[model samples]
Target chain A: MTSQLFSHDVQHTLDIAGIFVFALSGGLLAVRKNLDIFGIAMLAEATGLGGGVLRDLIIGAVPPAAFTDIGYFITPLAAAVVVFFLHPEVERINWTVQSLDALGLGLFAVTGTAKAHDYGLGAVASVALGVATAVGGGVIRDVLANEVPSLLRWDREIYAVPALAAAILVAVLIAAHALGPVTGTGAALVAFALRMLALRYGWR
Target chain B: MTSQLFSHDVQHTLDIAGIFVFALSGGLLAVRKNLDIFGIAMLAEATGLGGGVLRDLIIGAVPPAAFTDIGYFITPLAAAVVVFFLHPEVERINWTVQSLDALGLGLFAVTGTAKAHDYGLGAVASVALGVATAVGGGVIRDVLANEVPSLLRWDREIYAVPALAAAILVAVLIAAHALGPVTGTGAALVAFALRMLALRYGWR
Candidate 1:
């Protein structure tokens, strides 16, 4: 009885895709911090899986997808391997990384909200979880790297706002019983577009 | 049908006590960092409940005890209030603070292991979760304060070792069918004593 907006397979794909991109950011940060390979791999895994793990725990999803799904566990390692061998090339494409990160943020926000709602959480709580799913891993990465969480810092480009907006849109669409694939994708696109615009315009 | 080692009421009481002490430490740090009142309260709550919340989430406890239990929610705020007006005096009593923190470390280790075991996790995973329950809040507090986690910093006094030892002992006792109230209390005391001795001897 899965809703169209909650296309289970598509959501899984996006979740894994987002995790890979986030892991790349984490790996890049670990390299910049002069961490060894182990540290890099650990950061990659933590950054990629931390948010989803947190969200799963809060929703009472035991063992978490990170622990249960081999793909979820291995994707970060793959990202780490990629980063370790070609970090110099990876670092040169900061814009590309940011764009992918925005996409990750958007996908996580929409999917996370949908999943939370599926678990019978109220809309507001679902939206909050969605934002957490979008940004939680980066917070863990910063903590491990001894940096202040960008989510809490005012100097960073507006990150959580777009996620919050996208999550809320999904919640609204769900409440209105109109959360088909088109609107769901639209909600994610809104986050991506807003984030890209913020990056381009140097918003906050 | 609770086991002697898993006395539910006693566990809840210890959890609340540990949370309060942890919150005091968090509030003290916030005060030192010149955070405002709201920030102080937030830190207090986060520091007090963060570890337990993490444990609960991993073990499939929904909503978290922090959210479901009024006392769990309020104890940290009370600690924050105490810290707000009396931080100077509180800081002067660092020995007392360390002692309470050690006791918290011990209680959380023992109780966390028991809870995870009750949830059917294997002994090793239960022990790991126990240590996490003991130290996770401090890590969160330090991270939010923009300090490197004392857990990861070797320069700090030995911390995780005692918690780990306590948790392992509890797991072993459970496996041996000897984890009654007496042995459970003894396990907690081991962590407390180890931490105290470490502080006294400047174990790093």
Candidate 2:
């Protein structure tokens, strides 16, 4: 169970990347909702960091990394700007946005699970927190937009399930002392593939 | 500056009362939204404990009191049950509910501010967290119900302001070495009266 499979720098980079992708999705939603620039920025920040904030809080991490890291705080605003300028073009490329969102979900699920484990939570709680970290932001965004959370809707695609699967697999691998870059990648890939498959097949 | 003005038993009782009142509001909303029993219970719990959970997380308190204390966990469910059975009557007494809600808000704001101070946060942060603890649950509840949060709506009566006032007062009193049961009670009453006044006059 090597916790340092990826150096801190690499992990931080990936985290930011995930946040950016998630923020883009949130920003696009704000645009669709016809919210003003401030709303777009607000939603982007919430959607990008909500899950991580929730995870950090549950794990007793004070002043969450999202609040402390200037980079993390600014990435969502950058995503909002990009969306504000290119929303029409971005809307046309819905498939691409969704694919990246799936990638973000997978990455966050793995990372969140690992962090929970680092905080000494048991496997079940780690997996639950991982799923929350992956989907919580979207739930918050949808709620703020006065829409039912897609993750909680029966008719929606199987979003949380893939994240849950990834988290569980990661927890199991860690428990078996086989967790490393390969297994981590494997876990994320499994979740990403499942999400993509759900999109393609209209899985509910 | 005495943190022990109220005995632990009394404080616990007050906490449960606050949770009960908040949960009642959530449950009433669930009934109005035509949600099922499960939804009512879920919203009840969310409204009752969301703020405290959020506050605990920010202050690095693990497994917040909501998760650890059986009373906290059950009080919301009890409120849900009462609403499920007597919603028609509850709806008729809307004024009563609103008054109690104001009391809960004031109580939570004071307690939250004091707790934040206990956690060594400065005055500003403590006050901010106090307001969050007072209104965060209702925001979560409104969001889950797919409505613009009353706290964020410009047309609504002032809600957050009273909580903020109470929190600031509590923080100031604590800093001045003048904090005690009297000051705390006075702060809460000021907030409660302000809220009730806002309700009566439709203050936005």
Candidate 3:
């Protein structure tokens, strides 16, 4: 394993950031559901961490990060706490939540692809897993919260597509040995832009 | 690939039955989320069939049942339709939903274990996967619905544990070559009884 390819602190930061956004979405959905604080926290954690845990387990990554890292597990709890108190205000800023969601989706795609590649999977499989991981949490969240998953609906606003693009971008960068901060930023930027445009245009 | 184990019609029936219950749960949650019909159907499909699709993919079961058998996909949609029209009646019978949910959990666990055994995994791994398969959809459903999964919560009745027992029972029967209808039904009954008792006692 190349040190430059996978930095623990870097990955941890990205995962934490992703968890924050996912938990935010989950919390907001709980507000929509009119659930109590406990329900809100539960939803946030499940949405923020469930997909990555599933992906890692399927790939035989032991002690899935959610179990291993207290920080990753607690991030969603913190998010839930914030949302529990500020739910109405949070709902008032739906646009900001949506934007953060897009950013998180992009970051997760890149990180998921990187992790899959580290497990010696081929580029195609890695990218596919990345896409699955990026959206899988929301898919689960929507199903539990009883909304249609934005990714699977015919009216989806390019959710999975952006993840797909981000994964492909990461895989290409890795293949070309050009996956430094510049390319990483470019990949995240591309995914964010695509998702935002999709939202603005109501693209399905 | 044993000819004796291939029961296409039975599998079809079970799939549909499972879809009915699963989609009901998902659709009910969607109603809770206040999503539209499209969102309800989307969640219904995800919660109803996503686990099986995921299991098949992991086991390298090509094309997957969702693709090969139209019924597998259609069942969830049908279920969504039913719930869309009859949610009030269904909601009134919460206990019935819980009972049926336990049944679905038991059946899925057994089937998941059998499938994993067919894929040549060890007993421990197969049982774990079985538990995952049985509860994964519900977990996803909770996350999407923005609620804490009843299974993961400390206060709810024991859910996944009974499914785990059922899977272990089925695995033992299969190993002993005594997994006829009698044994299968016996094991399922045990699971159902355990779940019911737990509910009655408010066991966590």
The better candidate by lDDT, 2 or 3, is 2
DockQ of 2: 0.22
Q: For candidate 3, lDDT tens digit of each residue in B1-204?
A: 411343757655765777678878998888777766666776787788767767776776643455445566677778788778988988999899878877887777777777887888878887887788788888777766667887789988898889889889978887787775567657766777888889999888
lDDT of 2 at B100: 89
Q: Order candidates by DockQ, high to low.
A: 2, 1, 3
Between prediction 1 and prediction 3, the one with superior TM-score is 1
Work out candidate 1's RMSD over C-alphas: 6.2
State each model's CA lDDT, in order.
Answer: 0.88, 0.87, 0.78
| Model 3 TM-score on a 0 to 1 scale | 0.58
> lDDT score of model 1?
0.88
DockQ category of candidate 3: incorrect
- Candidate 1 DockQ category? incorrect
State the lDDT of candidate 2 residue by residue for A85-123, as single tens digits. 999988899899999899889989999999888877777
lDDT tens per residue, model 1, A1-204 = 214575778878888999999999999999999998888999999999999998888878767889999999999999999999999999998899999999999999998888788777777668868988998999889888887666655456788889989999998999898898889889999999999999999775
Report residue A203 deviation for candidate 3 (angstroms): 1.7
For every prediction, compared with the true complex, DockQ reads 0.21, 0.22, 0.09
